[model samples]
Target: MCAEPGHYKPLDAPVGPEPVAMVPVVQLYARDVPGLAFPAGTDLLQILWCPLVHEDDQYAANPRLLWRSTELTAAGTAAGEPPRPHTVEEDYLPRPCTVSPTAAVEYPNGDLPEELADLLDERFDDLKEKQGYCYFEVATTQQSKVGGYPGWTQPPDWPHCAGCGTRMEHLLSVTATEPGMGRWLPLDDRDPRQGISAAPSWQAEADPAALDTFGHDMCLGDLGGMYFFVCRACPGTPYTHRYDC
Candidate 1:
């Protein structure tokens, strides 16, 4: 219940509950992502889970992907601090932030291809009648990304590869909606007089009592999203996940 967060100092295991531990949900590397295949000798890419509520992927939160070798993997080198889960599902806790690898340029938030989703829904209804917005709400993005396309709310189930069934790829998106408003926020948390529009203004341009410091607030159920998938031709890279609310 107290998962260490008052800025350090709190390690000394041993409690009643037998098995639970699995936090830390993201740790990429491979020189901060640029193509990502990572298997031959691995360069890190962890993820962890067990915060609870896992009636299997549809109920969400069960992660566990590892890809290691940036040191710590041969039975976790000399591992330590990672065993807090006596009781969780505090909406699947997650508040240990610090992963900033931005590199935009995404499209397809609906998982298209019904002939480009009816010609991009008539070019997004003529780009919402001459740019009032909505090219999938400014080029698709729901938050917490890596490789793209999965911010789907429901419809695209997309998980295949149970060891060579193929069709896996996606690889990330632990989103309960990051971008604290408007066009995917982050122009240094926006509001430099706020005018880089495309029909912006869902608010949170910054400091409205610190919009909960934007993202990873993890209430991931009514507002779900867990996505991860891999199987790079399987052989230790196997993985799968998909949640949507």
Candidate 2:
């Protein structure tokens, strides 16, 4: 079977349970991705990943999120290129494209369990208009490339910190596609003939699967995403990571 222009057919060979090289996919400063309240003194947000498969339940590759203090790490010099992995799943790699993070309101997945939605109806509807879509739909903003607040599905329960048992705050999401890139293509990108294209040689050479993972990571055929949360109260505590389809 033929693959889509920017997508790759899954390989017949077996893939991973080990770590592959990691590369930086996107980096967002607190200013770039709005609405997020980062812990004081740590404002840089980076999303990096190993293109190869990992031992994840929903997806093979687990992307990593790091919060850093730019003042301490800044080297007053141009940044070097990110290193490439030795091997990767063609379907789990991402293309090299610039990110323009825009703020957007998001909604819960329309198919969430009725019982769960019923329980939060008052809270969800607080910002929702009587005649419009539910609060989860119209009032939430899906920021950056990460799929914010898990639309089309109920969000995973709030995670708790292992150390303090305090509920963590939603930091950000790392997603396969930028928010609203599909349903609302930009004016310059509106041509239907302008279909997906292959990744450039530099990206493809770094990892052949680069084109396949364009915009978002592929998780078991569904474009899956990862969520990161940090405990604001406990500054030194470990953060939490969650995977969702």
Candidate 3:
């Protein structure tokens, strides 16, 4: 009687179509800073979900429902909170003066292209032969959309001091004499090319040709061992010097 005879089949006849699991969806984004939420890592995908009955606009308002991955969530994304692990990998961009697959790569400025790197390598050797060691300042002539370079500008009087938060005029300048030496250093951690050294190396002499080209006065004996490698327009003024360091 409780089974209702032939009409009442098994209580789990169709097996309830198996419980559907809530599959986790992940999304990624290229953020200015790290941990910005993105929808599916730039590669889009479609997802099905049950909308709340109270939702006024269903498809139009919440057409694409995105889920965030733990890696991209800021303090777990419950509300407006700064993201965790705020270190984003740098994207390398190409420069107009350099030969690259594209016009630019999204990374720190001064990242020289392969072709330009080769030029610097040659210049480095050339400078080393004449001077004790070679130095260079890899930079772009273009103005940044975000304003001011990582620090300085190519033009002298163009307010290098303001945006960079330092008086660029006071900063010392260095240029790569070696061809390709200024390009991205090898991934080899053991190599000195991995990063720039803070202190200037006294391994080479100054190139007279570079002096003539840059036009800065060649004080071969500025401090006995300290000679300046500057341009004609950048003298007497102090600059926030940046080089391989």
Return the top candidate by TM-score.
2
Q: How good is model 1 by TM-score?
A: 0.33
Give the alpha carbon lDDT tens digit for every residue of 158-229 in model 1: 989987786988978888777564346565665555554633443336555555775668867766788888
Best by lDDT: 1
Per-residue CA lDDT of candidate 3, range 116-199, in tens?
767678776777688654344323312111112332222223224433344332111222221122232212211343233522
Q: Cα RMSD (Å) per model?
A: 16.6, 10.3, 24.8
Q: What is the Cα root-mean-square deviation between model 3 and the actual structure?
A: 24.8
Error of 3 at 151 (Å): 8.2
**Residue lDDT tens for model 2, 85-186:** 656665566666665443444555553568988888786666455544455434343323353554322356668998789877666665543333233222
Q: Which of the two candidates, 2 or 3, achieves a greater lDDT against the reference? A: 2
Candidate 1, after superposition: displacement of residue 129 in Å?
Answer: 2.1
Show where candidate 3 strays beyond 4 Å.
Answer: 1-73, 76-126, 130-134, 137-153, 156-182, 189-245
RMSD of 1: 16.6
